[model samples]
Target: MSRALFRSSLPELGSFSAARLRPTAAVLPFSWTTTTTRSFNSTAPIVEPVSSNNAPNPTASQVRPLALKKSHPAAPPSPIADSVKNLLPFLAAQPGHYITVHIHGFPYLVQEGDQIRLPFRMPGVLPGDVLRLNRASVIGSRDYTMKGSPHIDERVFECRATVLGVESEPLRIKIKKKRRQRRKRQAKSKHRYTILRVSELNIKNLEEAAAE
Candidate 1:
């Protein structure tokens, strides 16, 4: 009875194990397929290639006509012809001379090697800089004098000055008081000026001024 029961149970066990191990189509519920194709649209806009050779050259574009410009008239002839003729000779014969130089419309009576403190500060100049003074009112020696109607011709005289440095005024203080209140305010100022020395002064000859 025991052997018959064991053989009967073997077939039932084998069939149950085979059902669990079997592959099923239900595992994959859906499938997919892919296809590749070229796309075309007649409404697309076309772009034309630009030609670099058609562009104008940079050098050709820069060429332009130069317009003619009018120039200012020269200064009128010197007013003192007779006085200048005698004065030039006498001025040359003198030993020492002094010139009244006009700097920024202010006249400075100076001789060679005289240091002067200008009223205003000079720009773009440093120590050891040499400046040519062109405008003058008078150039004279001890006896004779040559004066300009307003300014002597710059070509007639050559005056040079050397920059020494800058000088500053002492600090100035001014006090202001309110009429009703006891409050008071102070204003302070320190002004700077340029210093120059007359380095050379020479009277040019008539021929030299005329040639220029």
Candidate 2:
């Protein structure tokens, strides 16, 4: 193709100075949104938050011992009733008497010279020590029986026992083991008993009981 023919065939553009550019409608600058905050006064006081876990706790060793409770005092003695005073001589006249004595709230139907093995060992007593029994519920002979309301008076009868010694049971060993375990636990237990023998048991006459 010729240069004149190519120039005549091409599209024409106007001068560059008269070109329409969007200069008045400019793009706004990018910005983040602002939030309003309240300001506090400088003279106001600040409160600290309290937590329960931050408080100090007391240990077991620093704890104080508890006070022991006071025991109830014993009751005062009373005189014998008139009905018992009248019939007491008849019960005391009989021979071969048997008494149901109580020691530590336990009943023992015993006669003179009978031996007793207490289930638990008695404390504060050694062999050959004598103990006077003052509590009894029933006292009877072969022909007559005398029953008391809860307990007979100590002035009515005299019973004594001599501590023999302490007897111990054989040691018992128990083995405990778990299945497929190499370690085993062994527990051993042995118990002791106190021996006592009744030495004297006598009933008081009417004059003797009244004088006491």
Candidate 3:
């Protein structure tokens, strides 16, 4: 009876051994080997993709400086052309002596050391006022100082005069009357004129002015 029980246990043990062998056969060495290779390839550095053909590098000379490529413009003439241009030629020729300077639209002419009694009083000036005479139509010399054709280049002359004092004219009366009423009013008015003495009317030579 003991021998029969031993035989039965031996068969059961063989069946368990076959089941273990089946599980061991399912685990393959190739699977672990392929997984390790895939991981290594993923971690490896990738080379930049290149074209089939190669090209040469560019140089610095081909690019231009922005400053060199930029541009500019021009300018205009001065308005004092009439006063200075004609006076310059005359001044250049003359060595000494006074000149009669005539302002544009004014009938009177003025010379150095001469006094000018204007028709109307000049405003905003006291005695001994130095005025820069900028607007002039004619500038004359003693013997052969150059005269302006009509207008002179304003750049030429450096003529300046000084104000002396104010002079008043005699009183002139104007009588005013109403058409309907028998009433009359007499208005008396006196005008004061500005007196100016020509101080300096100098013309600097081109060479002298430019050199200085």
Candidate 4:
């Protein structure tokens, strides 16, 4: 049927679009209530992982190669000089010998029964502990002298020292102040030294050295 005939059949549907359906911009009569909640203090509890030396590799392509350690090559041994071999026996027979013994790269000319004060304190050593000095640059007597370019063979001469009590210097205090200020800064320092006495020094004979 036509639209006019259908509208006349029902009077209740007359002018429904103009009365029931409101316009888009028009305000509603009853209150359409709606409850909405918002949260502002919420946070994600998941933590991001940090990269470090102990972290595991994710794939074979990401794996790093192991580092190789570098090592020093060994130096060849040097032969003993001809002059030292011939004169060692003559020097051993002489009496009253003195040797320049080296300890920690510092040389000290000491003989048997000579007391020496080391410039610094030697750690882990107590009184009466014996120390065998192996490095030397010179060994001599009244007339003859034997000198090594850097260090002599340890078998040529034996030198020993005994540790004595430590020696401490007197306490020293220095006061520093400004030209016009009463405030002063005091600097204090105290140093300790190790005392050692050469106990034995012997020049080995050719026969005795050969047997060893």
Candidate 5:
């Protein structure tokens, strides 16, 4: 009886599997077929024609005139005074001279071979570098002196300084504290300065300055 029931179920299962394996045709709407055919047949993109009335005109832009600038004449250069030209030669002939040279607006009275410690460190200078001192207030020897109104012309005198090395100050410690706080802090600072020596100083002759 169990074998007869199993044989009857096998025929129903075979019929269901044959129905699933058979292919079925799918039907689509007329509008869907038309849209797909149009997309495949189109080879170029569609562009609408632009009307000439809405286009910008090249001649419609107005040309503006440039403004005229005013012209001015330059003032004449001032010539050196006759008295200074006459006195320069007498001052240059004397020996054993001292110059009041100005560096960074501060005046330093220095002679040849005098070592100077500048207040600030000089940049781009190394040991044995020679620097020319141009600004001077007074240039004098044992007999004659040539003093400028404010500052003597740098071309009249020549002064050169050699860089020796940099000198640094000792480290300073300052104690900082609050009124009610137990914690205290110490601030330390050290400053470095450049050292220079006046190597050569001379007053240029009138003929020499004119030739240069």
Candidate 6:
């Protein structure tokens, strides 16, 4: 009876060994386990997919910096040189040129056969007397510029106009009468202006002016 009891107990100990000795598969730290009382927690934080330096990509709702346009500054004006003014007499002697001529500080850009109405009546000149205009500031080319002497030589350019005589405008007569006053005075005034038709605009060569 003792030998039979030992044999049964030995079989039960072998069965317990068979059930406890089976190996369990290794579980990764990140893997979830349903049997855990709280879900399996990760010791390491979850890493998201990144673009460049491990920084997470922003969403479409994020604001982006705007590209700015660069503006160009304006160019400065050209300065006039003193050397250009010294060469003007030779330049004026050339044939058929345009000149910016000034008369008594008032500037006029004139060529031949231009008509000018003087602002006020010019005194001491008759129909055929010639007038020489000299003051000029600039003599220009399409690209090059030749400035004149601070004041042009009075004898340099001849701007002769045929004085077409004085012209009178329509008479302006204003009658003065008060609301209660019976006496009325008539004020009459008339203005006459000189008209000049430019007959010849000549920039004579020194040789030509010398011969005359």
Query: Number of the top candidate by TM-score?
Result: 5
> Candidate 4 on 63-130: residue-level lDDT in tens?
33234222423456676578667877788888899999888877899889999898899999999999
> What does the lDDT read for residue 45 in candidate 2?
77
Estimate every model's Cα lDDT from 0 to 1: 0.81, 0.80, 0.67, 0.80, 0.84, 0.63
Worst 10 residues of 1 by lDDT: 30-39
Best of the two (1, 5) by lDDT: 5
lDDT of candidate 2?
Answer: 0.80
- Per-residue CA lDDT of model 2 for 1-212, tens digit only, reads 69987776554333333344434433433232112222333346779765544424433344322332224335566755775777677778888889999888889999999998888889999999999989999999987677889998899999999999999999999999999999999999899999999999999997898799
Model 6 stretches astray by more than 4 angstroms: 1-82, 85-96, 141-150, 177-180, 204-212
Model 1 per-residue lDDT tens digits across residues 62-161 = 4222332224335667666577665676786786889999888888999999988998899999999999999999889888788888988998889999
Please give the lDDT score for candidate 1. Answer: 0.81
Q: For model 3, state the Cα shift of residue 108 in Å.
A: 3.0
Give candidate 4's whole-model lDDT. Answer: 0.80
Q: What lDDT, from 0 to 1, does candidate 5 have?
A: 0.84
Name the better of 2 and 6 by TM-score.
2
Comparing candidate 2 with candidate 3, which one achieves the higher lDDT? 2
Q: How close is candidate 3 to the true structure, as a TM-score?
A: 0.48
TM-score per model over all chains: 0.58, 0.57, 0.48, 0.58, 0.59, 0.47
On lDDT, the leading prediction is 5
Query: Which structure is stronger by lDDT: 1 or 2?
Result: 1
Q: Give residue 171's error in model 2 in angstroms.
A: 1.0
**Ranking of predictions according to lDDT:** 5, 1, 4, 2, 3, 6
